[model samples]
Target: MTDCLFCRIVAGELPATVVLDTEHLFAFRDISPQAPTHVIIVPKAHYANAVELAQAAPALTGELIAAAGDVAKQDGIDSYRLVFNTGADAGQTVFHAHLHVIGGKPLGPSGLDLH
Candidate 1:
């Protein structure tokens, strides 16, 4: 999807404060972070949403979760929140599938509240 924002980021067409990158995943700082160390880990392959890809590709799913853990460790947060806003009701702004790893404080009810 050429119009996808995350695809652009994965392709390096858009500038992002990247935290980590692997053959299958790209982890970068969220432009509108919800925590002090907020990273969005996305797969290189485009998926519409979490539910759509959760079981379709096991390897990709494992890689995504691993990347989130790696990012949390790198951010030096003992604990972090991993979130996947599946649909519009969950507040997913972008259609691309991504895992939000946010920490660096006692995460509140709303995820992290970077503010």
Candidate 2:
């Protein structure tokens, strides 16, 4: 957990364009943004992935999701994508629980392809 990127960010050891900060969650702009407004939300406590976070801290899990909605609303996004990649095959580069709030333009039918 000490080496986790999100954890380091939460600890203020890294620099990120902060969007929102709550008691238990942190939201920041993604460095390599997939959309015009791409934000990554993560809990202050570390977890390997969504499933792990959900299983370990259900309340925090809810908070994480609610934070996503708050982020979208703050960004004035009517429609957006909430992405939670679970593994390497699913495009999860970081082994930490996080949610991606991606929106800014029409995402097309698939919506998965953010670019």
Candidate 3:
């Protein structure tokens, strides 16, 4: 986990535009944001993905999700997307467990894409 980028971010070893932070979770803007307000929520403790998180820390998992909701409301997004890419097949570039809170404007042809 030493090489995990999110872990570094959580540890303050890397820099990110942090929006929120709790005892166990951290939320920051994604460098390659999919939406106008794309934030990534991550746990301070490292885990590979949702499956791992569900097993290792179920209570914190709920807390992280609740935190995401708080962030969404604060960001002025009435309807947003919470995405958890499970693995490489699901477009998960970062190995650590995280949730993407995407909203604000449309993208792609239909104005619904995040790219």
| Winning model by lDDT | 2
CA lDDT scores, all candidates in order = 0.85, 0.88, 0.85
TM-score each candidate: 0.92, 0.92, 0.89
lDDT of 3 by residue, 1-115 (tens): 7799999998889999999998999999998887888999999899999899999899999998898889989899877778788978777888899998888875434333322
For model 1, the stretches where C-alpha displacement exceeds 4 angstroms are 111-115
Model 3, position 26, has a per-residue lDDT of: 93
User: Higher-lDDT candidate among 2 and 3?
Assistant: 2
* lDDT for each residue of candidate 2 in 3-109, tens digit (9 for 90 to 100): 88889998899999999999999999998887788999998888899999999999999998999999999999989988899988888888988999999988776
Model 2, position 41, has a per-residue lDDT of 95
Model 2, C-alpha of 84: deviation from truth (Å):
0.1
lDDT of 1 by residue, 18-103 (tens): 99988888989999887798899988889988877787787789889988888888888879888888877778878988898888
Q: Report the error of model 2 at residue 26, Å.
A: 0.5
Q: Which parts of model 2 have CA positions greater than 4 angstroms off?
A: 111-115
Query: Which window of 10 residues has the lowest lDDT sum in candidate 3?
Result: 106-115
For TM-score, candidate 1 versus 3, the one ahead is 1
